[model samples]
Target: MNIQPLFDYIRNHVTLTSEEETFLASKVSYRKYLKGQFVVQQGDVCKYESFVISGCTKTYYVDTEGQEHIVMFSVEEWWTADLGSFITQTPADYNIQCIENTELIMISSDDIEELYIKIPKLERFFRRVIERALAASQKRIIRSFSMSAKDRFLYFREKYPQIEQRIPQYMIASYLGITKEFLSKIKSQIILEQ
Candidate 1:
């Protein structure tokens, strides 16, 4: 695997020397998943954080009623992991399934610790990534509470236009917390207004 995308993303957050970059690459494992394969299943311990080199995956939870609620989607250049499980080494509540044949550069929790000690700059990169993720999560929570479903859908479309085309409509509806029929109505209304 080229893994250049991971290096490019890291560079955007923190400057790394060539040696540091090479070392980081050595520590990560490259893996590929076919469509519909699970990266992390609920009740399993999430051992590594995966950075998407190509393709898309959805992080979801299957509720007691057996309905799958999508928490988020990870596309090219994004990272996916069960954060709580990966951090604490506990069973994950979320399942990460590939929507397309995906290539990932994954680093285990133990490898992350070693990287932090050897190359402190990597710690800064990871910290910044987590901080931004936390902020975005908080904002999404607020949006869920404040925005109308249609508005929320519109915002999602604007934010993830690329994602909208890659996944099925039903999955998109699940992510938006709306029914597929409702999403159709929303789309129809938007089209009529245009």
Candidate 2:
């Protein structure tokens, strides 16, 4: 499979020589999962940091009451991994499931360490990626506390219009910390305003 997207993504952050790109590509393997398949399960150690070649996956945790709380979603050209579990080699707290049939290029933790040692620029690239993820997470936390449900829904719609089309409404509601019924009402209100 073509890895130009991945190379381009890294190039946006740090320049990579052709040999470095080839070496990076050699360390990763391709895998595919059907919709509803779990890439990483709760209580199982996550072995790979996956880059989405296509489709979508969600990271979530299930409570004792069977409620699923979505932590994040990774669409095409994005990356997904349980950072703590991946780094610590411990059981994952969340499950990563394919929401759509997905293709991924995955590098194991060991391979990643090797890459960092062999190509220092990759370390810098990943640091920027993690920083952006943290900032987005922080912004989401602030929004959940400060923004109204309608405002949050509106913001989500603006930010990820494609996600709304691809995923179920209930999943979107879960991400927004709202009930599906409430989400329906919000959609209706938006339609009425139009």
User: Best-fitting candidate, measured by lDDT?
Assistant: 1
For model 2, the stretches where C-alpha displacement exceeds 4 angstroms are: none
Alpha-carbon TM-score of each model against the true structure: 0.98, 0.97
Clashing pairs in 1: none
User: Could you give candidate 1's per-residue lDDT for residues 19-129 as a string of tens digits?
Assistant: 998899899999999999999999999999999999999999999999999989999999999999999999999999999999999999999999999999899889988
Per-candidate Cα RMSD to the true structure, in Å, reads 0.7, 0.9
The collision pairs in model 2 are none
List, residue by residue over 160-189, the lDDT tens digit for candidate 2: 987888999999999999999999999999
For model 2, the run of ten residues with the poorest summed lDDT: 1-10
- For candidate 1, the lDDT comes to 0.95
> Candidate 2, overall lDDT?
0.92
Once superposed on the true structure, which residue ranges of model 1 sit more than 4 Å away at CA? none
